[model samples]
Target: MVLLLGIAAGLAYGLTAFAGAFLAVPLLVLFADVDYHRALPIALFALGICAAIAAGDAVRARQCDVQLSAWLMAGSLPTMLILGALAQRLSEPVLGTIFLIASLVFGPLLLLTLRAYANRMAPPPAALLDAPRRSFTDATTVVHRSTADKVGVLFAGVGCGALAALAAAPGALLGWRILERRLAGQPHLSVGTLALASAVLATLAAGWQFLFVADVPGYTAGLYVLGTTAGMGIARRAHKWLPQAPTHRALGCLVVIAALALWVVVVRGATAST
Candidate 1:
């Protein structure tokens, strides 16, 4: 059961870091009956590992824009460390309320993810969503020409980190949205750099929670790390043959939904049963 849960969690995360962590925390806390307080840390850590691994390809592509990225990180790191700890101290109700607020603010992005997935299955006008973004990768380069743009990124990154430290549910769409306008002009940069940086920052931020903030069972973190890395490797290999391939895209979306449903049912049922 432990191994099975790890794979399921990792697989979901492998598909996309946010999707994985968004759903995984409830599974670990509510279903696995790990304390919710500790679960947040583990979830954050898990996301960090997965995002970093997947972003490796982007790092190799020279799209990271190190200077601007540094600014973003500088703004985010302290908040992640601080708010993440504060989050650990809150009661479940308080945490839920906070998450509710974030969900309201950033909930539309998940709709976008849902829409993209539904479209991949079959075009749906009712989807009310857009494409699954590469987060910060496709955006941000054009902003580099001006200091004001970099400062904007810094503030945005800080905000994302603060929210992410709280729950990470909003960071996906929020992070991507932060970059969308900036990315509109710089088509020359590969998605790799942005991908890798987001992956790394998230991983580090998440890892801090797992290692320092939570009480994850023995080897659970290792399992998350290994599973996500392997999943990323698989994705990279597959991408070589079918860049932006329809099948892979669809598969990613369906996998997320299926896994998320599993998590909800298992966790929610367990909660009600208890």
Candidate 2:
């Protein structure tokens, strides 16, 4: 059961670049009867490895933005360390409730955002086809960033790191949204930048878990690693051939599904306990 759950979680992590911890921790608690604390650390460790591999792929593809990644990680690393320590002291029920609330709130908002983006990308009526359009060069030109933009990026990074430490990946979801807004028309670069930052954050959080929070088993970690590697390979290949529209829509749906699953786990556990 543990191995099966690990693989399932790893596949989620690799394909979406999020949700491994979200899926793994709850499944571990419910099915394998592992405590939330122990489950989280193991999941974090596995996710760290998965993110590292994905980041490498992104860098090799020349889709990563090193300056953006560095600025994001500057705020994330210390925040992760602090929040990870705090997570160790929280009760399982408290953590579960937090996860439940986050899922409910963020899930619908994300779905709505995706729908809106899709609408924006849809073609206009034939009457408008003759209307003047911005030149390709003008449309793709990189925008200058203000101080507010830099601050927003840093804030998003801190938020992402904190959530990750607490066994959630919604922070990464939020980071992606922020990046997408800032780096419009460059989806690959925005995603790759986030991937690199996520790799660093996950690794630091996992190391903290190993040293202070829990002792993860080698076999369980191995299973997750294997599954994530396979999933990453599949996703990488698919990205080459698939259109961006459908891919974004699919990702939005997957986030909703994962969020609902998390809510069910926490709510059911709470009800059972009471």
Candidate 3:
């Protein structure tokens, strides 16, 4: 069951950077009967591997900007560690509830964004949400020069880290969205850079949580990694022909379903205990 779950999760990760972790956490809680806290670290560990594979694919395809990814990680890693540790101190039920709320928020938002993009509508005008005003064409891609400001990149990283620490799954959606705007018309670059940055953050955060914050089930985590590895290989091969919009629609629906399922579990557990 865990292995199967990993494959599904990995496929999601490979196709769309946000869905792998988003799918894993709640599915683990629902099927494996794992606690929310433990599920978080386990999903994140496997997600790191998937992210690495995705990043490598992007690099090979010349879709990634390595330097930009580095700057994003510089601010994100430490923030994720600090906030994740703090989040660990919260009660199990509280943590689960937080993840549930985040899922509810991000799932529909993602779908909405997809709809807007599909129609060729403009995004919001906020500084963070707007497309970078200045861009220059390069041999490989169009570089959004204004988006590379060190301060802005760091701030975006910090925000992404906070979101990740709070709910590892939803954070990826927002992170992807932010990058999508900055790297407009460069879908692969946005996904690749975020994947690279997230891979480092997720791995370190998983390690820290395993050592100090939670007792990660080694057997379960190992199975997930194995499954994820296989699934990612398949995704890499089929990436060219994959229908991204349909895939994201499925993801949005599944995420909402998972969140509702998790809520039921939380409520049942609370009632039983009370």
Candidate 4:
């Protein structure tokens, strides 16, 4: 079952992986009895693999965005180090509660952010960035925006680090929602980059936690990796024929949100009981 789930998860990350780790963590911890202690690392490990695959795809698509990736890494790595160092001080319940609250709170904030982003004035179309925004194959299309808007690029990197540490959600999870707003009029990061970023961040985060925080049997983390991979596989099969029309996409998002909401409630209740 673990192996099966891990494969399913791998596919999910491979495809619309924006939220694979977020999608996988609760399920693995809640359903598979993979305690939070081990669950996060396992999810991260699988996410790492997912990131590598996405990176490959980005390279193929001529959108690798090497500069962006480097900047993102700069922001994410330090936080990862800080969070990993302190993960032990934070218990599973604390992390879970934080995850739950963050999800609950983020929805409204996201709405407001989206609205603000939408209302921004557009820059003249013909005016271009100093460099034509040239980047690798699998990168987001270059866009022109207010100088103030461009600076937030740093926020992407720093926030990714903090969020990945806090709740293991950096992909289409919170990051996607936020980016969707900021990049509304432009091509988003190549899906490949999004997926690979998830995998890489998750893997690194998981590795750090496993080495320093959790002391479970070695095999347990292996199960976590297996479980996430299987989950990705399942998600991949589900998305095989998924249409990306606006209607279909909206419906899909609602379904995932609903299911995740229910799962979260169930987990909270179970945790309270146990």
Which residues of candidate 2, in runs, are more than 4 Å off?
A: 17-21, 119-145, 238-274
Q: On a 0 to 100 scale, what is the lDDT of residue 241 in model 4?
A: 51
Note the Cα lDDT for every prediction shown.
0.52, 0.63, 0.69, 0.52
Worst 10 residues of 2 by lDDT: 122-131
TM-score of each: 0.67, 0.77, 0.84, 0.68
For 104-154, candidate 1 gives per-residue lDDT tens digits of: 444345556545644232211101112234445444445425877777777
Root-mean-square deviation of candidate 1 = 7.3
Quote the positional error of residue 70 for candidate 3 in Å: 2.5
User: Higher TM-score: candidate 2 or 3?
Assistant: 3
lDDT of 1 at 245: 29
Compose the digit string of candidate 3's lDDT tens values, residues 1-274: 9889888877776666454567787778888778777777787788778777765655555555666677778778888888788777876667778778877887888788778777532221110112232233442563556654656667778877776676665266656666776667766567667777877888877777666544567888799788987777777666557566787778778887887888888888878888
lDDT of 2 by residue, 1-274 (tens): 6666665665555444333345656666667666667766666766676667666756655556676777788778888888788887887678876766665556555556656776433211111112233355544465567878788888888888877888646266777777777777766566667877877788778778667654556676566556655555554444445554454445545545655565567667778898
Best by lDDT: 3
Worst 10 residues of 4 by lDDT: 122-131
**Error at 128, model 2, angstroms:** 34
Candidate 2 lDDT score at position 25: 66
Ranking by lDDT: 3, 2, 4, 1
Q: How many residue pairs clash in each candidate?
A: 10, 0, 0, 40
